[model samples]
Structures are given as structure tokens and as C-alpha cells.
Target: MKNKILLVLIAIAAPVFFSGCATDAHYVQTGDKQQIISAGKINSQDFATAANDASRNLLSMDPNPLDKVDRSPAFVVFSKIVNNTDQSVDQDLLTQKIGIALTQSGKAQIKIVDKLGEDYGNIDDFLNDKKTTRRPDFTLSGKIIQTVDRAGRTRRGTYSFQMSLNDPKNRAQVWMFEKEIVKQGTRDAVGF
Candidate 1:
């Protein structure tokens, strides 16, 4: 009789155990209120904020490079973007957004560097002898840094995005911009 009661109890409990795991999946926009806030690592919102600030500051210089150009848009090549943060981050997340915004403004053009080619031109240029590629007027380079602080259950994180625009002709930084993003929360939470 005990064996029969155990089997009955097991049968009743099986569905209850499985029913607890019915979690629905949903999509959350970047920087949205529902987005999971992480105090330990950088978030998509941080990238966006950095991109916006860098683009604005770079474009609004006193002697606008793009406006100074009489002909086509001023060319810019992306230099090594150092990721000095604790978390692994795709550098494109920062550069691409700024590039798109700069491009959309019709002020600047970003040239993709080709490893095989000698200059910042298409890979096909490797076969051609003609140096048809226009040299970049400026080089853009930057670094991303992260800082963390913890006090008992409270935790804080700060991320800094720094960028410099260097003139290829003079090899001097014509413009520099930095944007800082900070997040704070409790350590009791996961990945705080």
C-alpha cells in the first residue's frame, strides 16, 4: 500500500515540477526600461552614448575638416581602437555607430583598411598598380576603459570612451573627445 501511495504521489508531483519552468521569452530594446541593467560590465546603451558624444564633438570642430574640403568628403581611416576594459567588447560597436552618424551627416567618410593592400582601399587594389586610393586626411583612434568599485552589497562601475582625431599631414591630434558612463547597483544581484 505504501509503494502504491508513493507512485501516486510521484505522478501528481511530476507536472507541478515541470510547470514551474514555463518561462516566456521577450525582446527588449537597447537602453529600454526593461533592459537588464548590469553594474559589472558595459551595456549597449554605453556604446550608443559614447558614439553620440564622440561624433558630435568631432564634427563640430572650429575648423571643420569636412567643410574645408573643396571637393568630396574628407577621408578618415580607423586606427587601432584599444579595448582596455575588463570585459571583452567588439570595437565595431563603438566605431560603426559613430561612422554611420558621421557618414549620414555628409561630412566625413570612413575608409576600411585592407591588410593585403598597402593603403586604405579595396582588396582588389592589390592587383592594380595605380595608386587610385585617396589618402585619409585624419586617423581616428581611441581606447575604452572600465573601473569598478564595491562596498559590501553596493557596487559601482564606470566606463570611459576616449577618442582622438589626428591629422595625417601634421601627425598631430586636431580634436579629442571623451565620454564617461557610470552605473551603480547592489552586489546582492547577479553580476552586479
Candidate 2:
């Protein structure tokens, strides 16, 4: 009797489990409907969305001012990026992506603020070469904030990505950008 019951249970459960997973598989974009979201940690799409926003703003900048000054684009030194989130995040994943996009667009250049290092060799060479080396007209930096709230069976999360471009020479912040991503669900397992 015990064996028959166990066998019957397994037979019923197996088909349901397999049938639940029978949807056709297909490729999906990073942030598309097929993407997975986890409540415990940051997701790749979150980073990608943030990167895309940053890239758009950085590239949209006018490179004309720097172009007229000679050849080198605006040289920027990375500033202190305050990670104001509860989770430990590798901030470079965000900054480096933006830096690459900015460099490729020819609108700005990225530099290390630290003055002492063998790494300075490249920047020094540019400064010495009249063909290159333009002082950074702007400094880029920002912070990320995550907030969570729970009501009944629903949970809500909001992640805010903020960035600012400051004119170091003038000691003024020129541009400020902020983007917030929010997700809500009846259970944490299904939300981001």
C-alpha cells in the first residue's frame, strides 16, 4: 500500500513539474521580458540600464569646445564615488562603462586623480605632446541609492542612480542626472 501511494504521488508530480517548464525557449534582450530578476542582489539588467543612461548623457555632450582648443578632448580625473547602498557593489562596473563610452565619443577623457604612479606616464606624455593633452573641463561622479518597502503581501524596491559632471576648474557642477528603477510584486521572489 505504501509503495503504491508513493509511486502514484511521484507519477502525478512529475508531469506537472515537466509541463510547467515546457514553454518554448528563445533569445531575449538584456532588459526584455525574458530577463530574470533577483530580490537579494543587483541584476545585470540594472547595471545595463544604468550604463545606457549614463552613456546617452555623456555622448550627447558637445565636443566642439574641446575640439577648438587643439586636439585632445577634455581630460577628466575620477573623483570619489560614494556607494550609499546597503549592498557592497563594485562601482567600477558603472564608472568604467561610462568612461569607455565617453572616450569613444571624443567628448571627454578620463584620468586618475592620484598624482603619483607609473600609470601617470600616459597622461604626462599627452601633456607634453602639443598634439594631445587637454586639461579636464569636467569631473564626473555620483551615488546610488536603494529603498524597499513592504505592504501586506506586496514588496516594492527602488534603485536610484545619480551622476554629476562638475567643472573642476570653475569649482561648479555643470550637469546632474538621476534615474530610478522601481519594481513591485506580491512576493519578493518575483520582484527585483
Pairs in clash, predicted candidate 2: 75-136
TM-score per model over all chains: 0.73, 0.68
Off by over 4 Å in 2: 1-13, 16-32, 61-71, 112-135, 188-192
Model 1: colliding residue pairs: none
Please report the candidate that would top TM-score against the real structure: 1
Model 2, 1-192: lDDT tens per residue?
999999999999999999996767777766776677755356778878898897786566565333433446777666656677788887777778788887888767787443322243433343444333445555677888888887887777788889887655455676778888787776434222
Q: How many backbone clashes does candidate 1 have?
A: 0
111-168 per-residue lDDT for model 1 (tens digits): 6442324363432332342465665666788899889898897788888899988765
